[model samples]
Target: MTRSWRPWIAGATGLALVAGAGVIWSVRGSDPGSGCERTTITIAASLDHAPVLQTIADGWLRTDPRVDGRCPDIRIVAARSADVAANLGDARAAGGSAAPSISPTAPLSPSESAAAAASAVSDASRRPTVWAPDSRAWAGLAGTRPEAASLLAPGAPSVALTPIVMATTPDRAGALEGRITWPDVLRQIATGRAPLVLGTTDPTASTAALLTLMSLADTDGDGKPTAAEIAGPLALERTARVYAGSVDVLAAQMSPGDSAGSAPGARVSLFPATEQEVLRLSASGDAPPLVPLYPAEGVAPADHPYYVLNAGWVSARQRAVATAFLDVVLGTAGRTAYAAAGFRDRDGTLAGLTSASGALDAAYRGRPLPGTAALTEVLVRWRALRRPANVIAAVDTSGSMTEKVPGLPISKLAAFRQAGIQAVRLFNDRSRLGLWEFSSDLSGSRDYRVVVPVRTMADQVGPVSQRETIIAATNRLRPHSATGLYDTIDAAYRAVQGIWRADQQNILVVMTDGRNEDEDGFGLDELLGRLRAAKNPAKPVTVLAIAYGSGADVQALQRVTEVTGGRTFVSRDPADIGAVLLSAMVNR
Candidate 1:
């Protein structure tokens, strides 16, 4: 059992400065010698504790803190915990080292050199010396990286604890004052009995959001879930309804407190947040004081593990500095800072909590996070079970695609076919996907024609897997005419808008290789006007465009997608277009 220390109250200044700013940027300690002689360590941590960490580092620096025999400088950068894990995962996948630099002496094209340099710089920025993500849940997701075993030192201690809770107004919470479990909440959401619209942070970008989904996955209280449990139909249906975009969106809709009276536009009912976040919300007083309900079944508290990266970039002196930093975090002053930030002690006990919040006992220590493989299975199941989608894949089969790609044996059209075939596999069986080919004189008068009608992958009218049909159709795609870009985009967007399903994400995927060449079709300006006129935020439809090869009109395509809150991917080389297309599909 962990011991509870004296309740130490922090000054109001700590609350105002620490929680208010999402990120804390600072350099601590006196300047070290120039170049290699100087040792500077960078630590990227969760946004919530950046301020608390900054305070600790600043104080230590003023006292000339040192590790081993050398005094060092420390810098802290605040970022989302999921983002940190992803960065490390990326570096780990790339041979557990920073991206290799382009050889200056080797002969290379300007574009090739630029691409290599850009990739290297991006990888370097993400590889920090130390990482303190919000919870160990990331361990399962990130442990697959090549350096995962070494990234987190053995016997690492958690600096603080904050249980994930459902935040709602005090009055709403009072009606059901007893214990609540994740299953109960899921039931409420599924049946429309939920008092407020249940929402959370983006699972792909937030650790809390990911944990919320995992908890929901194993409603039977079976510790970690098996593959069958994760892949079951009931779990998929339940999880699909729980996701409500990112937590920030829900936070925006919140009004300060109960007294404000629900405003005209404000409408979030309940949000999944850390206990610290719940306390922070209550302290703001701008919204109604929220009641934090610790689910009775179990909880997954963010333990905030301090990880030291085991990379070659980290020097001996830098490792020593990292050790010193961890000491300060687990020490007396660090405990006090954590209390001020509305966190529980390592044992899940409330120590020196100055801020007011709903009553919570110290007994709510959550279950141990699932093993690496179990967590991976949960994530994989989510991808297959997420909300179904409706996509109209518009491919430009203009004559330019007939030209052979320089480095490969296939033509541009063949590469796009392969890309389309692969990308379709990423979607769930419930998703409806259709294919269309566009070029001047696609028909007697029309510039585009639907080759495959949009239908769910499970539809019995076609092959057993609708995805395979789409891939097979790609084989028949042939380049023969001039590009009819503008008219095709307008037609597809309007067509989808008329039948947009509220339950599914409606999207228009445009793969083109050349500028508009239609002599009689609608112009770019006319198409943009139609899109703007038909725009409805409530029934949003995104247009994802892929400009394949050097001849594509990327700038023009960007304008069309930007108006719909979508993005355009440019692939100057057709050989690599498959990867870019796949990325666009997954991110969307």
Candidate 2:
């Protein structure tokens, strides 16, 4: 099938099945492979494979006699584990009337990862016959499957499981007397009593990383770390680092006996089971001495599960292979393999598992991590906490900005003036808006004067005055001097800094169509550094940037936003300026 049709089919099927009974089932007819004819089946494995899974794969192929001549050919497609959900989605869209399949070569993009899991149950063409994810938490994404309750016959085997553990340096573990609690760990990092270093796979992309964060949030009794919490004294005690991209990169950087001055160095520790496997390598002399820390507050294990796609496209032969494979993986041998990989074999012992394992088992099977929902709620709350923002609109009114479009008679300056007027009109009354146009020299010679300070102006009063002021400022802004975008933004930040309140959010909305050419008491880097360090220290301020036309250092604006958790929008169309500014204000 064509690539275009694939995603459409997957998305449609997953949505249909999930919205309906949650459990998707394809009618079974006479099995195509009933006579014991062999067929090839592809397995899409996630990137993070626990040791137990590898062991099971090795043992299963060797022991299964049917595989020698009679059974289906099992072709393994080693793709990034995160892509499995998306692949399953595509399979579902293709319709399960026939056995589901996927293009092994296809990989998900960054944005695609967000919808991958959901699309699996919702998409039609991308569904896979079977999906072995690193955590059962993913099952929730499939929606409620009541049919799953009745699908199991008298003696059905269970899915997969993997235990999560913390990996730390032996010296670090010794400081805590072998075991540690989450609170104590946080305290040590906060108090500088112990040099705390922890690593995890990327939370945005890795299921393991997400689960680990969820577990920590549960332990903290907060959904997730607040911006304030992340910026707290603890993070400053040492450099709180985020090893984005891959765990292997972090592992390689932190592996002992390697260079001590590398990015994270070998002293860094990792949390969760995947890292524990790395620790095992150290124990075996393949790496350095890495200790596993079982937090005293309790430990949580990852519940890895293998799910079957019940879309309409699943053919008789594929269904048979899927069933047979599930049986092989979840059966006695499968459970043993999981146990060998540090996971508790609780296939037939859920009640006993919880009763005996206590907190660890609770973490594995609990209904959403305790603080996850709350943490997410808090994060959202914090998003708008500093609701009414105080922004200074620093516009570059350089001579180049007056250059007419190659064919158009209207100069860029006229377009900017119109855009600035529209932007001022769109300003929220709750927001204290000001206008400052600068070129080689400050247009009005008022270096840092408030055009409109913080106050809820009536519909016609404040906004009208602000618009008039902006228009007058633009009219008087002669295109005689060079652009000092950096200097203007710096002065605006300082001006706004004087009126910034702890409870209110302060923002510097800078619109520049050119680079910093003139006025330079302080360089761009120094000015940005001052802004970064200029936060009230009690309340944080964010900087939003809008790049218009061309050659306007977009990267510089993005850097400012990244450090402040703000955002940057680029637009060549002058009309879009107002909407972009409004979006930044609302988002801030």
Candidate 3:
């Protein structure tokens, strides 16, 4: 484990992982070559700070820094902060597995022993010798995952900082600039009171998203979002179109000119992103400048912390190099590099251009992140809420779907099928779901055909499972017939009502691009009549209909949903289907 290395450079709210071996950097700088083995130290950084870290690494290389009598080879790569912590956890798990077996195990020969040693080194090589996540929150988050336990070394010093914020154009910022509470916006959208559309990256992978959810759901001052208040924000997932997976992409999509800050795939009015991103977007680029909508409470500043891993694989010399490199990062060189990259110094002061950066114009106030336990609670509650749905998804397979959407490259049917599969994937095994494809005479005299039967998602159907069958069926579906919207809704609604599990949330979802064209089947009036007549108070089936493309009859879809006390969402652009499908399928 004593691989020689060059001088080291540079890790979070703090998921306070169990204390590991502490690193103390007090060594003097040595010459370029130490006549020792050449070692490479990799720093896996969050997207925000990866570039800046590379700058620091480049400077360190010039100095030909040496630590513990070994020259260091520093490498920096962009990676999710949570992933690095998880990898460390996995590495420790691997280390445990690599340990020699006891009892009946036989001694390995020369060739066999060399092969085993090579496997061990290969695993160690893949893991970053140094982990530099964007925020302290990641450390706190890592504490929640059992496998990531003790993966981060103790005393990870905060080097640079940036707050999590809602980024929007200057004009829009005026309306949303205070202690911006997100739940209120979500509730307004859910109840049909507001026309505002906001976008966010996936919370599971993005720290900016996770911290925003933590803030949005934390209605009470308890520092954790309770189930009671979290429902409002939970709808953010359903209306299905609000998710924008990246800051750069969302910023580009949301221009000031697009009068309607509509579908996330198109443009959103507001988006949650890192402060540096907002600054970078506004400072330059064809995209409009963005301002911050600071939460009424406070912001979770991404505190770039430096962690010297205490894992068994990180030898004394590697730890020494990591520790020394951390010193370089906190010094004048590191601080200067980070500031040049639009990050704040360890102190509250900014590096000029504060107004454009979307901070409170030289007024930076950041609150301490919650404890690991509190952070873990928020995640657990989110996982508990964003799951287990009972749905009857009906997709329109009309010939009209064969035509490509105006603004998108893919055909309407391709986008529709993708959206359906994504919505079903969001559901868990505990839920019961069914998939149906509809067109003119899709099945002998019937306008709809059951691709998958309603049952527990995990249930097996002959050779195919419920989840697998729906995905496969939707992919195999083609478009060559006419729309039969009315009858399909009636049948799916009745199907949901028939099984009617009191324990689960039951709802029927309809995805269509056009109005009813089947003269042989029931009309819109008859369909609504059947739904109204068959509606039982005990077994309620809410209809969530998604009208894809411009051809959809909004009035007709609206009337159909109103009968079942459900809602209709219109996706004028086929590209918006995935973003719109989740919010449509998931019932509150």
Candidate with top TM-score is 1
Write candidate 1's Cα lDDT for 55-86 as tens digits.
77777777765567565666676755654444
lDDT-best of 1 and 2:
1
Tell me the lDDT of candidate 2: 0.49
TM-score per model over all chains: 0.57, 0.47, 0.56
Lowest summed lDDT over 10 consecutive residues: which window, candidate 2? 1-10
lDDT of 2 by residue, 1-588 (tens): 000101122223332111111122221222444565554443444444433444455565454335334555443333344333323333223443222222211122323433332333333233344555565443332222222221212222235444444655565555553346555565565465655565545443455554554555354534444322322222212233435455555444455433223335434555444433543455455445555555555433455555555545556666676667667677778766654444555432332222111223333332343333343332222223223556677767677877775456777677667656644544434556666666764545433234444343233454565446555666665565677776777777777777676545677777777777755456767876877777565665667888877667888878767776668888766545545544454345
The runs of at least 3 residues in candidate 3 whose Cα sits more than 4 Å from the true structure, single-residue gaps closed, are 1-37, 90-95, 98-123, 145-147, 177-179, 184-195, 238-240, 261-266, 284-286, 351-360, 391-588
Ranking by lDDT: 1, 3, 2
Residues 1-588, model 3: lDDT tens digits: 121323221112111111121111211223435565556565666777877776776677666655765667665546556444433343344444432111101111234223222222343543556778887777666644444556665667988887777787767655432345566556554565544456777665567777776775565656755434444345555543556546777777776745444534446777777777777777777578778766656656777887766566667777777778889898989889888777778765686425544345457575666666656555554554455667888888899999987777889898877777766666666789888889978788899998778888779987978888888888998885888888888888888888788877788888888989989888888888898899998888888888888899989999988889989998888788776675554333
Output the worst ten-in-a-row residue range by lDDT, candidate 3: 100-109
lDDT for every model? 0.68, 0.49, 0.66
**TM-score, ranked from best to worst:** 1, 3, 2
- Show pairs that collide, candidate 1: 196-269, 201-247, 255-287, 256-286, 256-287, 256-288, 257-287, 257-288, 258-288
lDDT of 1 at 169: 68
lDDT of 3: 0.66
